[model samples]
Target: MIKGKGYLKFSKSKNKIYVYLFGRLTGEEKKKNLFAFGRLENALENMYQIRESDRLPAELSELGFNFDDLDEWILALETRTTRNNKKINLPVIEERCFEDVTNYDLLGMSEKEVKSLNKDETFKMYSDLLEMIFGALAHIEELEEIEEG
Candidate 1:
């Protein structure tokens, strides 16, 4: 099942999460983000090399996501396709947010944007973005259950 189905928002000030769904997304848009999300999930899996613990900081841990949950949620989002008669794995992601599926292209930052941030700044930004992604994953799981039930 497609989880989140769009863009997810996390409000730092209010400590709340929101999801904006793009129920009208085109096929190309969904395919693009699906690949993007798959890439992101693969990166995270490779970096951690383990998804059995809480990877968030003490403060952000309050957001209620653990690496394990995020891992499982992303696994649930996986879909299969065939390219050149070869079975390939992809994600089932939809474009439903303030912006289009381009939001899923986490690595789309320009060289200038990348260089402007020092290591610490970049890590902070990465952590914050991760928090949002985890929140989105949890929401997707819930939405999937809702749809199933």
Candidate 2:
């Protein structure tokens, strides 16, 4: 299942997380991020050389995401969209937000121009580039809040 359809599902989900985090899309549109997390757990299990844990802060930290952000990002995937009644929001994340996703190819795309794109297009470009940058593993996933806590 991790070959074709599974790959498609992971790609779509990775896009959802990126788009949702960027504040360009409605919370209603973000789907669950659990599938990616599950696959990660499986892959880690296979990596017998390295130990694994349900709390993902260490693994995610290695990816350069801050500890505090991990909880909120997971919520965007696995739990309610809003923290309270208010919308979960973000500043416009550009190449600065991620070291791995941005590249020389995007050096000419102004941050303003990028922020102006519609959510669908923004997500597409972000996910497409991320897939290119980190390949399929970028979509692997993180720990859910409860799982981490």
Q: Cα deviation in Å at residue 97, candidate 1?
A: 26
Candidate 2 C-alpha lDDT tens digits along 64-90: 444344444444333224444444332
Assess every candidate by TM-score: 0.30, 0.26
lDDT of 1 by residue, 84-145 (tens): 23333222222121123244346466545655666466555554555677567667768977
- lDDT values of the candidates? 0.38, 0.36
Model 2: lDDT to the true structure: 0.36
Best by TM-score: 1
Pairs of residues clashing in candidate 2: none
Stretches > 4 Å off in candidate 2? 1-107, 136-149
Give the runs in model 1 whose Cα sits over 4 Å from its true position.
1-110
